[model samples]
Target: MAKIMLVDDAAFMRMMLKKALTESGYTDFVEAQDGAEAVKKYGEENPDLVIMDITMPNMDGLQALKKIRESDPDAKVVMCTAMGQEAMVVEAIKSGAKDFVVKPFNGERIVQTVSSILGK
Candidate 1:
């Protein structure tokens, strides 16, 4: 069972993601509402994978990604970005994010990304 972290400002998005992943047979989950919380929780939960939104209050995904990767070089983070954020996605990739997903969350894409990353 891979431990996964879901980080997004919107509670609905997190819930949706959790629901989708659970239905797909993923059980373990940790959630945070913003990048700041995510950074703090990363150390505590040490999840196998993270699905994080790019635009968030108090630190943003790119910053959090850097900090997490700094602490754990092997950390696997998948960024969630909106359309037209290709520049940030490039930066995210350069900063060590394992992959990315676009917002308005697609259940199938999210599941596929998670499965590929965790090899589940």
Candidate 2:
């Protein structure tokens, strides 16, 4: 099982992702409400993968992704973006995110992306 981190300001989004991941056989999870918390939890938990939201308070996903990458060059992150954030997604890819998933949440796509990234 992979230890995954789900980072989003919205509790609903986190819950949705968690549910989807759990249903997909990914049970181990660490959740953060925002980028600052995500960064802190990343260090404490060292999860295998991070599913991060692009827009968040106190840092945002891109900045957290950069910080995580700086600390662990091999850190695997998959950015989550709502529709219309193409530019941010591109920037995230440039900054070292392993992949991306768009919202409003497609459970299968999220699982597929995660499985692909983890080579499962």
Kindly list the per-residue Cα lDDT of model 1 for residues 21-91, writing each as its tens digit: 99999999999999999999999999999999999999999999999999999999999999999999999
- Candidate 1 segments exceeding 4 Å error: none
Q: How far is candidate 2 from the true structure (C-alpha RMSD, Å)?
A: 0.7
The CA lDDT of each predicted structure is 0.95, 0.94
How many steric overlaps does candidate 2 have? 0
Task: Tell how far residue 16 is off in model 1, in angstroms.
Answer: 1.1
CA-only RMSD, every prediction: 0.7, 0.7
Over 4 Å off, model 2: none
**Candidate 2: worst-modelled 10 consecutive residues by lDDT:** 98-107
